[model samples]
Target: MYAIVEIAGQQFKVAKDQRVFVNRMEGKEGDSISFDKVLLTGDGDNITVGAPAIDGALVGAKINRHLKGNKVIVFKKKRRKGYRVKNGHRQALTEILIGDITIDGKKKSDSKKSEPKKEDKKAAPKAAPKKEESKKAAPKKSAKADDLKKIEGAGPKAAEALVNAGVDTFAKLSKKSSEEIKEILTNESSSLAHLDPETWPKQAKLAADGKWDELKQLQDDLNGGKA
Candidate 1:
């Protein structure tokens, strides 16, 4: 039997005892991991496919080792502008041996089923208040925190810092001056102090106004968030 499954954001066709290399995952050598995102499975003439992913289907594996892939060189040049950059990168990877692929079976990691039942019984009385609190807070928080990573040169950590500083939404970010944004980034961490925010406000303004086409055009002209 063979199963197609997603492991660390990539899909692969695997079977029992097969060794595969995938993107770096959390776990040491000899640790076991199970992937529940089984896309499809086949055995002889019978075949089963999932609508996105099959429910209660899992592919188990054991980590064999961790290593880095071959280095790749990236080169960028702007003709007649005297601008050229070269860099090398190596991707971290993990090797694992595939085990049994099970369908409609209980997961091996679901050992705390009884604990949840006890907690549910105790929390049942206060569920109404918790629901009310969550309902009241969820919309406000979701509406305020825009995906700042959509802006050019903004990464996950930068977006998180901007959200924590109250410049969570595009509208809020649009109002902040470049210098103010720089100060906020610098205050958050010395590592982020090098980021240039000159084009961030302009980009945020376009995003807040829902001018996605214009924003894309502007971003196309920007180099690493610079003009």
Candidate 2:
């Protein structure tokens, strides 16, 4: 029997006891690891394919060794600019021996499935109280969301993310620390990961207090919303 599996981002057709070199992987030599991303499996005339990947299927392997591949040289030059660069790179790789492929295996999701579904039954009754609480909280929600873009580093997307996360008003934002705001932005999207929130809380505080003059002065001194 042979199985097609993905390991370290690359796919390979492997059989029992077959050795293959792949991208560097974690774990020491002789460590046994299993790849659950079995795309396809075949046993003579019978073939089983996956929708993306077969659930509960596994390809077992043992790490043989870790080594670097042959180095490749790269040369670059800019004519008339008198600039030249030469570089060499060696790819780190690991040798693994395929052990056995199993079609029926225990999946991580199986345990989650075994978890008692009683929570769903209990959650139904709690929904009514939550509705009543939301009705009572309507006044708080009626307050207009602040234009967080006024803060030096926050953009339209950042403002929208804050609003969705319940930090809609300047008062709410000012109460949060820079680290908290940074975490929020990172959890929202990876594209906003590079934004600096170091000065956000202070700027929000000024805005929340309606000190436009001081906020403008602070923004003028800031470099791209950074201190």
Candidate 3:
């Protein structure tokens, strides 16, 4: 038998032993989940439908794993504004298997809610130390932001995004991984989603180290800020 049920704010037509991948959910792998918002059910020649949702219908499912979908590039440019941005997104996904479908069901915990699964999250931020040390370290680490536009791939828009994401310093930009930097530029808050950061760090490293000639050469080799 197959049943159309709603789970995690989406409807799905599921059958026994069938796998279903949905948005990221709270449960870890191997946890069991159920849905009671069955809208329709069919078996042989009989089909049962609900006005909005079936009162006694439930669909059981088991969490197989939680994973990320493919990387999607987002690019934006503004005319005459000298603004261009590029970013990437990877959707968080949860894979589950439909274990059982019940029409006249009573026992099940409705997996009605799921947590926020926004993407492009950076690594967990490091905790701060004592206040005295933090005060002393702040100024030393937080110098005047570098001119990000001086770097090969960093245009005005890309520079603005890097500054907003706390990668304003050449040292800071050089220290970040390509993926992490990419995530920062493409994060929801920034509009510079078209910025490619592949060679950004390399350029930043040269800038941080004050190698202008080398940076110029590298920029000559790059196309649209890529190496």
Expressed as tens digits, the lDDT of each residue in 52-155 for candidate 3 is 88777888899999899999996766579887878788867889999988875433213221111122134222322343588997777556777888877666
Alpha-carbon error at 23 in model 2, in Å?
0.8
Candidate whose TM-score is highest: 1
The regions of model 2 sitting more than 4 angstroms off are: 106-227
Q: Cα RMSD to native, each candidate?
A: 7.3, 12.5, 17.3
Q: Tell me the tens digit of each residue's lDDT in model 2 across 9-51.
A: 5789999999999877779999999999899999999898987
lDDT of each: 0.86, 0.85, 0.76
Query: In model 1, which runs have C-alpha deviations exceeding 4 angstroms?
Result: 106-208, 218-227
Error of 3 at 106 (Å): 9.2
Location of the lowest summed lDDT over 10 successive residues in candidate 2: 113-122
TM-score, one value per model: 0.56, 0.48, 0.46
Relative to the true structure, candidate 1 has a C-alpha RMSD (angstroms) of 7.3
State the lDDT of candidate 1 residue by residue for 42-86, as single tens digits.
999978888778777999999999999999986767789998888
Worst window of 10 by summed lDDT in candidate 1: 105-114
Instruction: Give per-residue lDDT, candidate 2, residue 110.
Output: 66
